[model samples]
Target: MTFFTPKKLPKAPLLVVIITLMGAFAPMSIDLYLPAFLQIQEGLATTDSEVKKTLTLFLVGLCIGMMFYGPLSDKYGRRNIILIGATIYSLTSIASTFIANIEGLQALRLIQAIGAGACMVVGRAVIRDVFKGKQVAVMMSVVQVIMMIAPLLAPLVGVMLLYVFDSWRALFWALTFFGSMAFFLTFFFLPETYKKEERPKITIGDTFYNYFLILKDRRSLGAMLGCALPSGITFAYVTGSSYLYQAKYGLTEFEFSILFGLNIVGVIVSALLNIVCLRRFNVLTLIIFGLCWMSISGIVMLLIGGQSLIGFFLSTFLLMCVSGFIGNNIVSQIIELNYDRAGAAMALNSSTQFFVGAIASLLVTHHQELLVPVMGISGILAVIAYAGLYQPWREVRASIEK
Candidate 1:
């Protein structure tokens, strides 16, 4: 009997759009509740620090969840695990609306994030299953562009929900709707991309072993760090941007919002440029250029040091654009290198990003003074990661010796 293949799956553009939405669960869940943090604190009689833990808990959950879902998807198939994740996500989001205390809400958010992890892990795996080489980079850029919409619109949506309902619980209701939509989309439209013949015999031991092998490989570690360290810089900005833009730079909320939105737009443009440039250059070259540019941008921002708002903004914008270039290319390389264990590779890659982000967030929250320096240092570390760990020169030398 002829078995199904991704070649017969939905058209590439449509598939890209669908999986991109699946991958957006994290940003949507995080951003949707940000505007309602004060409301949640008041409603639950909690402290600001406790409300902050919810974000930390969510990231923690993402790390734990992706670790399992990656190997699970490799064994079971992408569609099945995504369906399970969507179900948990939707039900937990609904349950969150009924939660009364801060502790209860935190627990529910953690569970909901675990469910979101399935979407993220499997979504990238699906892309790797169907696309090859530079095609992966191009599609990844498209995914980044589309996934950015969640963060761009979520805070506005959160504010609107708060205005309409006058309660922080309304934010959970919105998430419920989003989760439900993801469920229906996955159940109906998403095809099984991980072919049965390709699946490994994954048990608990097998899962850990897969992770061990990936993490132990120098190139994999390097590529994973290449993607993750820059993410730490982005999260640092996310954690500290309000303080930097409003209190330090003396910008109004209106002006800060405009600048924030413009930064995201800059990222989108950069991703689009990556797509165009993929036709002329390989993923590795672009990734190297991106890291170098990010380092320079961060250094420039540090030199500006809030001396000029325009200089700071331009430098920051350039630094953020690296997100569009480095992440997709590095991820594409990781998945390519670990094609036999794409799920495990993505799990390690994505979990490391959350872990790094959590650390960065803490650093910025405590010492807002370190934000620019952290950004500059993260870019420098990313370059070191790519050069020291990835070590493309070894391959060049071997090829010449041959």
Candidate 2:
């Protein structure tokens, strides 16, 4: 845990808007190009494995980059690092548009992800800096609601762009435009949230120590992994959807986008409902509920994801919606920890989730043609998170009773 306290705060609505945009960076970057995978496979002369490498490698870069950016943001400042990171990301997106080879696209996406990772980590830190426990949970749900809209719209956007340009490169160009807008908006509008006077020193040893120490805390690990494991559930659907819908179900690109948007619509509805429910329930209770929903959904998917299209679709929708709840609640628990060390806590919370989620995605991607693995991983991880967090829940209850 850290001792650094926040400085004065900015206006709340504006701050949420900015942070939501930062949060949107990752999903938009990802979902925007998903509809074009088949086209890219043809245009770049790449195999499905190679095309999928772009997704996995981007996640890898995001994981590694966040590990470093968390400590650096704590030492330096959120605004500076975010700007630097977004600039790099925007530049890479632009560069990706011009790359003529699959290897070059893969390399650029990795670097682009490194830059995007800054936004993902620091946005949460900014929230933790200003808001306390319950407020943080509510705000996170609000943020998740706004951010969820990106994926809902992104595939549709990608399809329309593909229709107009008739090329996969159009998606990269769109990313470049968005990235440029983010750079200018952040530069002109965003303020530094972390206080300078109370900042922690930046050192390699201290950073690693802080990271390990957080991991060592059972409660902290519980919260981090609880949020992370569901990510695999979502990513599994994401990585396999084009194949699942197109090859197996015989959906066209336009229809696939509509179906994907329908699932994301579930996420938005859940997030909205979560904002209302947060007023009456504690974070842990909601997390358990979400986990239960995920477990049920996964079991159903395993039993039916391959045989019944409606069953698979409904189960996938449940998994997506539950993800928002689990992540918001888990991160709220992390934010409730030592405020001084909120940056490091958030970093640990984020990087681990990405790392774990990345592995989960990689595993499922390897067997994308199958639904059994997705069901097992998604269902098992939900149960695992619930079991792990139950101890922490008991501890909280004990402390409250005393």
Candidate 3:
């Protein structure tokens, strides 16, 4: 269990599978409740804006929880943190079932998101602790595949739950069940990837010092921002797409779900492409290429004026596929750059991405009538991130490595 002392790679394929499951926690939490949003609003007698705030709160909690879990895991161990977080998540998800008002539901969702965030941040950091470079990229691609499945299936599952129970609360009950299952799996099969002997001493000053060090490292910061801005773009799309599809495009929930699921197929295909590309190219190259594609897709979306479903799907699918590459590569680069403080690096990365996403989502939700502006603004952010963060990061890593 020594940090650098490998132990037969711990059944790598199986380990990858488990890690992918761990990584799916965030997507599951977000997507599972999506189809129920309108139902919940109606049931609670709240406005659309009020219901949207619940999503904002969940993201805020996710950011805060991600910031906390990384240092906690570095101090303790991965398995213990996973168990505690999963338990909290499960209990809070069940509590969500009993909430009567939008305010109460929002509170429970925030707690649930916090637990989900810990799972995601720690899971990524654990992978970094156990794997490196190309192997990490391969594993991340697999994780992307697993993560895509949640969004692909969540709405369908939510729709089915609606048919079965006619109540949105049943979705929370289902999440509780999923959380409980994840808890048992982690408790029994997830080993402590970070050994106590290898862990750095945990102290307030040391934590701040690590944060300062990471902030000072241009490559690390660049890679982090590269991931965060693109993530914000995706979050903007997620926040706005439902309204666009349902109200603007006049699609039914069933149709929208199918379209959403189809868009996720792009992620799966891109992940497969990433796995192949990682063997030949460095992570930074992959990230740049991905961002280029994302930029083009965003531009197309903006130009299309949000008029046609086909145009929307085409642009979004391309963007999501590109995201498959960016997601894993940026994280891989950051983890390599900040290997000594992998936990803190990952925590910071996750927190920043979620924070940016929350802000982007809020902006989109409030000003959704300006669809072009939302897409344009997010697209511009991606372009700035690519030019400012990713390009400079690649050059820096090359100079240092040489």
Q: For each candidate, what is the lDDT?
A: 0.81, 0.79, 0.78
lDDT of 1 by residue, 1-402 (tens): 023223357666777777887889988898777666667778999875577678778888888889889888888888878878888998999999999899998899889989998888888888888888778888888899999888777767777788789998888888888888877766666678888888887676797699889988999999999899987777777766755776677865445556776888888888888888888977777888898898787778778845677876777788887678789988988987888888889988998998887787777766777777787778778888888999977766776799
Question: Which scores greater on TM-score, model 1 or model 3?
Answer: 3
Per-model clash counts, in order, read: 0, 4, 0
**Residue clash pairs of candidate 3:** none
- How many angstroms is residue 142 displaced in model 3 relative to the true structure, after the best TM-score fit? 1.2
Which stretches in model 3 have alpha-carbon errors above 4 Å?
1-14, 390-402
Best lDDT among the predictions, by candidate number: 1
Total clashes for model 2: 4
Per-residue alpha-carbon lDDT of model 3 for 252-351, expressed as tens digits? Answer: 7788789888878888888888888888977767777887777777788787747687877777777666777887877887887888788888889988
Candidate 2 per-residue lDDT over residues 96-194, each given as its tens digit:
988999999989999999999888888888887777768888889999998888999999999999999999899999988877777666676676777
Candidate 1 TM-score, C-alpha based: 0.90
TM-score of each: 0.90, 0.94, 0.93
Give the candidates in order of lDDT, highest first: 1, 2, 3
